[model samples]
Target: MILITGSTGFVGRAVVERLLAKDELQCVAVAVRRAGPKLSERVVKHVTGDLESSTDWSAALKGVSAVVHCAARVHVMEDTAANPLEAFRNVNVQGTLNLARQAAASGVQRFVFISSIKVNGEATQRGQSFMADDTPAPLDDYGVSKMEAEQGLRKVALQTGMEVVIIRPPLVYGLGVKANFAVMMHWLQRGVPLPLGSINNRRSLVSLDNLVDLLMMCLKHPAAANQTFLVSDGEDVSTTELLRRMGIALGHPARLVPLPASLLELAAAIVGKADVAQRLCGSLQVDIEKTRRLLGWTPPLTLDQGLKKAAEGL
Candidate 1:
């Protein structure tokens, strides 16, 4: 039996749907927070209360052989909470450790954590791509929490012998994807002229299908045990190029206006969104060679295929 946390989330829904289609996997269980879509009898539904350090997961851990933990306090543009780092760590780090400890006690063999590439920092230097072993330089509270969670998971594995597989992914997009990707899609749909044409910046992203496929592989792959992986679509593109592609997918002209990247950054900084501008104009790439070599896996969908799917979804 496999227990999946955050089954109602964007990536989590895909993981659950993928697991449901696999007959070889005897049982699929979902840990949800509230009422949701109907589940087949084959899937056990456990209502886990608010994700916190003290939240009990014993019922969800029962009869579970493997765990796919997709729940986390994700990053947001404007954080309104008091002590955002504490809020993040309380749920993302301590809560995750608590779950892993209980899973280990329940005899769960493997624990797969879905983390973010922000653990490598927001962006990379020119011509550089983040590697799995790069010393973590997380910039924000969310990234720091994920980094701490990874370390804590490693410690738990060492103490309890529960195999821990960590996957750090770049921006993920697909059907039901939210945040920046959704905003970009909405803007494209409305045929908005974007000022990202001259901003030549490289960014790596993984599609939902490919990420879910990688997660399924890690669930039982012996080579995946106790390993950390950075995953992407194996394709890197600049902001202009990405907008052009998404525009093509949506049948919208890539109406991009040329503006100096520096000017754009300065303007965004003046508006209190230098970070968003950096994401738009900076380079953030990942090296997925290790993931490919170790897992002997390849992304099932190409960039265009994924983009087209996303467009259709929008």
Candidate 2:
């Protein structure tokens, strides 16, 4: 049996649907914060309100062989919490370890952790990419929490012998994608002129379908045990190109203003949006050679294919 947390989330919902489509509903269970209509009637559901260090998981972990942990206190643009790092740690670190420890005690064989590339760092050098084994250099509270969770999970693995597979992916987009990716799609569809035309920095991205595929592989692949993997679409593109492609996919063709990247950065800094400017003009890439070589895997969808999917309902 497989137990999945955050089953109502963007990624977790997709994972659950995939399992159902494979006629594995009888073998699947989900841990949700509350009982709701988001899940199907046929699949097992367990309500384990707001993940934290003390949440009970014995019921949810019962008879489960593997676990796919997709829950986390995600990053936000403007955090309202007084202690953001502590808040993140409560869920991303403490909650994760609590569940993992219980799962290990229950004899769960494998644990698949869905981590972010931010655990490596904010950006990488132009030609250099983040490798799976690179020293973790998390920049923000959310990233730091994830890094801590990874460390704790490794310790649990060493002590309890539960196989833990970690997968760090870059920006993930698909049909139901929200946040910055959705905003970009909305802008393109509306033909809003953007000042990202001159940006030439490359950023790696992985589609939701590709990420889910990799998660499926890690579930049973022998080579995935106690390994950290980086995943992407195996293609990198510049901010301008990505917008252009998204525009094309949306059938609206982006209206790009060829503004200088430097001027844009300066303006953004003046407005206290330097981080936003960095995301738009900076480079962040991940090398997945090790993932491919070890798992004998490849992203099923190409960048164009994934973009088309993401554009479908936008």
Candidate 3:
């Protein structure tokens, strides 16, 4: 049996659906915060209230051979919590370790963690990309929490002998994508003129399908045991090109104005949208050579194919 957490979330839902579709993998169990409508008749559901250090998992871990942990206090634009780091740690770190420790005790073989590229800092210099072995330089509370979780998981693996796989992916987008990706799609669909035409910085992105594929592979691949991997679509594009491609995918060509990058940055700062502008204008790339070479894996969907799927959903 395979166990999955965060079965109702964007990534976790996709993982559960994909696992159910497979003929070889029969038993699929999901650990959700609350009981909702059944995802499928075959799925076993366990209601584990809120993710924290004390959540019980004995009932859910029964007969489970592997675990895909997708639940997290994901990064947000403006966190209202007074102690953001502590809040993130409560879920991302403490909760994760709590489950992992139980999984190890229950004799689970593999634990796959869905991490983020934010663990390697927000941006990279032009022509440089983050590698799996690079020293972690998490910039924000969320990233720090993830990094800490990774560390704790590593220690658990060393002490308990349960293999842990970590995969850090940059900007995932697909059919049900939310946040900035969705906003960008909305802008393109409305033919809103954007001032990102002159931004030449490159960013790496992975489609939801591609990420799920990697996650599935890690479940049993011998090479994936106790390994850290970075995943992407194996393509990098500038913000302008991305907007343009998305516009085409949406059947509305992007209306881009050739505004100077500096001026755009200035305007964004004036409006207190500097962080937003940085994400749009900065370069953040990941090298997935380790992923490809170690797992002999390739992203199934190309950039255009992923964009088309996302566009169709809108």
lDDT of 2 by residue, 1-314 (tens): 89999898899999988887776447589999987874576579999998999999999999999999999899999999999999999999999999999999999999999989999999988778999999999999999999999999999999999999999999999989999999999988988999888998999999999999999999999999999999999999999999999998999999999999899999999999999999999999999999999999999999999999999967
Model 3 TM-score on a 0 to 1 scale: 0.99
Off by over 4 Å in 2: none
What lDDT is reached at residue 97 by model 2? 99
**Candidate 3 deviant stretches above 4 angstroms:** none
lDDT of 1 by residue, 1-314 (tens): 99999988999889989998998876698998876777887788999887889989999999999999998889998999999999999999999999999999999999999999999999997679999989999989999999999999999999999999999999999987778888898898898888888977889999999999999999989999999999999999999899989989889877889999999999999999998898999999999999999999999999888898888888
Clashes of each: 0, 0, 0
Model 1 alpha-carbon drift over 4 Å, by segment: none
**CA shift at 212, candidate 3, in angstroms?**
0.4
For model 3, residues 1-314, the per-residue Cα lDDT tens digits are 99999999999999999999999977699999987897787799999989999999999999999999999998998989999999999999999999999999999999999998999999998789999999999999999999999999999999999999999999999989998899989988998898888998999999999999999999989999999999999999999999999998999999999898788889999999998888888999999999999999999999999999999889
From the highest lDDT down, the ranking of the candidates is: 3, 2, 1
Name the best candidate (by TM-score): 3
Local distance difference test, each candidate: 0.92, 0.94, 0.94
- State the displacement of the C-alpha of residue 222, model 2, in Å, after optimal TM-score superposition: 0.1
Q: Which residue pairs show collisions in model 3? A: none
**What local lDDT does model 3 show for residue 295?**
97
